[model samples]
Every structure is written in structure tokens, then in C-alpha cells.
Target: MAKISIPTRTLNDGYQMPWLGLGTWPLQGRQLTDSILAAIELGYRLIDTASRYGNEDAVGAAIRESGLPREDFFVTTKLAGRDQGKPYVREGFSASLERLGLDYVDLYLIHWPLPLLGRYVESYVEMVALQQEGLIRSVGVSNFLDDHIAAIVAATGVQPAVDQIQVSPTHAQVDVVEAVSRGGTVVQAWRPLERNGGILEHPTVTGIADRLGVAPSQVVLRWLIERDITTTPHSSNPDRQRLNADIFEFSLEPADVAAITALDVGAPVKQDPKTWEEF
Candidate 1:
């Protein structure tokens, strides 16, 4: 959170989302609440959470604690895999809203396609209906592949406002990103720094960081920003939060970006969407 305003990319639905955000996952109870409160104090307006993460309540508490007008922040949450079917989608979203204590989320994402469940397209349909009802400002999907996007569009004739995917210097998913962007879907990288991955030790990124006199994380995020990609990087440390948000001031050169892309060896995925289930 720098003094300068964070830039935003308008969605296909005409809603605006900050280019950077704070991701809350596996963060719970008092720790999670405080982390969010600190992030808010640091000037972060975009906060990402999900029903599957089991911390929407904590997220809600932190937002209220900040004492800022609800309209002052942009909140994004996801529908869990367990709630993807027609039978549960509506009630599931209502439950999430209750937990968050918010009238409507800025963006509501289908957490994963879970093709094996055969409910993703219908789930998107349900989300569209929710949008029509004014319960969500924008609708989106996370961890959705190309076919998932096409199927949803066929069913609803609407591309999601944002496609939240895993992107890092070592696993850029260039082809998928190109396709998503071509269709006016904003690509938001979930783990831009590739936390818990070797990206922290990667020479190319570090080399750029050493030259730029910035943190390695800034190098990675700046590369994403340079390519017009947005990211929600999670950090509990107040100092790290500020550093992550401070990336807007510097940029990576074309060669640096290319070199970083070269590290894309199809880095190991945390889960295979085709075969994995979020529930």
C-alpha cells in the first residue's frame, strides 16, 4: 500500500478491480483477522478469500474492524466445489454472504471447474443469475482451463470478469493466458512469487533484483505487472505487505521479462484441476 493510488483494470462487465490484492488462505481466527486489518491499514483495498478457505468470517470481522465504509474496499470470494451444483449454489452463496456479513461481494468466483463433477457450467449459470439479482458485482472462475471458459461462455454468452490462475516466473502458462486475455478476461495470478517454490532462489529473478536494488518478490510481481497481469500476493508481515504493494514504482526490462519467462519449465502444479476436487 503506497501513497499513490493502485491502478485497476476494468472488467468485461465494466467493474474495476485493483491490479494487486491481499490473498487470504489457510489464515484463520485472530491471526487472519489481524493480518487483514493490518493490510487494510497499509492501504490495500482488494481482499481475496473463498468459502473453501474457511476464513470468510474472519475476513468479515477484519473488514468491519477497519471501520472503513464497505464501499471503500473490493472483496472477492469463491464458491466452493461442494456447492457447485444447482441444488446448492444459491444457498451456498447466501451462507458465504452471511459468514462475510456483507451485502454483496465485488467478485464471486467458481473456485474450480471440477469437470468430473459435471456441474461447473451450471454453476456459472447460477452465478450469472446471482449477478442478475444484484448479489454480486462481477462473476468469475478460478483454476478454470480453456475448455471450462468456452463451456461457460456457451452456456451464458458471458466471459468471466476475472480468471484467477496460478502464474509465476517459472510457470507462466503463456498459451492459456494469451487466450484468456484475447477474450477480454482479466488474468489474475494467485501465486505470482511462487511462494514455497524455488523461485525465491532463482538466479535470473535474483539477478534482476540485485541490479534493481529491490526485493526478489518485487521483481516477480513487476514482471507480471509489466505483462499486464494482476496478482494477489499473500504476506503476514506488515513490512512485506508494503514491499509487495510498492512494486508499481519499478519495472522489468523486456529482456528481463523474457529471461524470466524462459524459466517456465511447466513448474509443478499444486493440484490437477481435471482430477482434483476442492470439496
Candidate 2:
């Protein structure tokens, strides 16, 4: 049998997203275009961008230039926290669509919980309505805790299709993962590699990389794959981009999974919204 690559998971809302995608956060200028085009050429069909990323136009330009039809790619963008009102959600999605030059996106997400903003649930209501209008194919949330998801579902009687959180070996987020999984929502891991602070060079990951004869980055990505969470890892180098996609060739052992799981140090890499950040 042929080797199967790029596994996909079915969302509760009846859509499919590839197991791995190309993240476009913090990637800007000519580098954004070059990386996106390189990723597309490297067989990565899922491109995860957001209004906050400030690269939607670059992403759109590359997509148009790639000669790939809208159906051939899975494009995901998010509504910025500042745009979390009923009318603003509507305008935000429209602006994102305009920037991407698409009528509908594969997935639309609320970029942050923004509970302090005091209108996240109301914004989600608009997102649900937009789905009905055929303007949004799927609606979801990002950085949403269980309480946040429950509030939205209770108010609207519709659950978000996906909940994206920052997940990695270091920041496991097991509680959030369990809650979202129990709610039948797909979980997407942003910053899945946990860049900064020598994550890729960590002893646990580098050891696996040496054993597998692959780069440490590949080992880290595969670690996410084995966990079954959808990951969008951002890389600009051509070889690194291609190597990131090559994770499916080898499988990490169950023991290796357990070891990687133990690497979580009981703290998040970035600002933790639950305790530190106001959002």
C-alpha cells in the first residue's frame, strides 16, 4: 500500500482539516509571500492566517499567484479581538474575505476569548448567523476555555466547530484539550513547536531526532502529530518547510510519546490569559 501522509480529522461541524498546516503569524513582508508559496509547492494545502497576523493580503496574493483553485486549499483566518462585536464581526469577516479575495473561508475563528471586551458570545452569535448566510463555511473560537465555550453554546444553542489553543510538549493544556474533545470540537494547536527558549533543541526532542535521523524540528512536529491535535507550524526556510511536511514517514513509539508528554513544565510559554493576561 502507498504511504499515507497529511492525515485529516473530521470536525463536529462536518468539515475536514488536514492534521498539519502552515502558520502565518509573525511572518510578514516578502518573507511571508515566499514562505507561503514555498509551502504550497511543498504539498501543504492548509494555510492558517488571521486578521491580527497582518499578512492576509500577502497570503491572498500568494494564493492567487499559486494557480491553485480555492477548492484545492484550506484557508483559515480569525476575527481579531478588537473586532468582537456583532456588527464588527460582520465587517471583520467581510474585510478578511476581501483581503483573501474569497467569498468563503474554510474556517473562521474568534482570535481571542476577550472576555474583558464583554461581547464575545454576542460576536459568536453573529458568526453563527453568518454561517447560515453562506458567507462563512465554518465558525470556531481560539484560546477559548471550557467556560467560554459553554457560555457561547448556551446562548446560541450552537457549539463552535473547533477550539484552537496553544498546545505543545511544554504547554500541554490537558484540561482544555479534554473539555474540547468531550464537547466534540476539534482542537488546533498554535505555536505548536514552542519556538523561543531552545524548545527545538530540548534534550527530549533532540534525542528523538537523532534516533529517527531527522531534524529536531521534525521530531517536535511529529510529536504533535502523534498526539492527534491539528498543528500549524510556521517556518520560512525551504528545506525546513519541506522537512516539516515529511513527519509522516516515521512513527514515534508509545514510550516516546509518554516521554514527550512528561516534558510539560506546568507553565505556558507565552502570557497565560487565564492568570496573567486580562483577556
Clashing pairs in 1: none
Please give the lDDT score at residue 133 for candidate 1: 98
- In candidate 1, where is summed lDDT lowest over 10 consecutive residues? 1-10
**Per-residue lDDT over 99-134 for candidate 2, one digit per residue giving the tens place of the 0 to 100 score:** 888889989998888776668899999999999998
How far does residue 207 in candidate 1 sit from its true spot (Å)? 0.9
lDDT of 1: 0.89
Off by over 4 Å in 1: 1-4, 267-270
lDDT of each: 0.89, 0.83
For candidate 1, write residues 224-248 as lDDT tens digits. Answer: 9988899999998888988888888
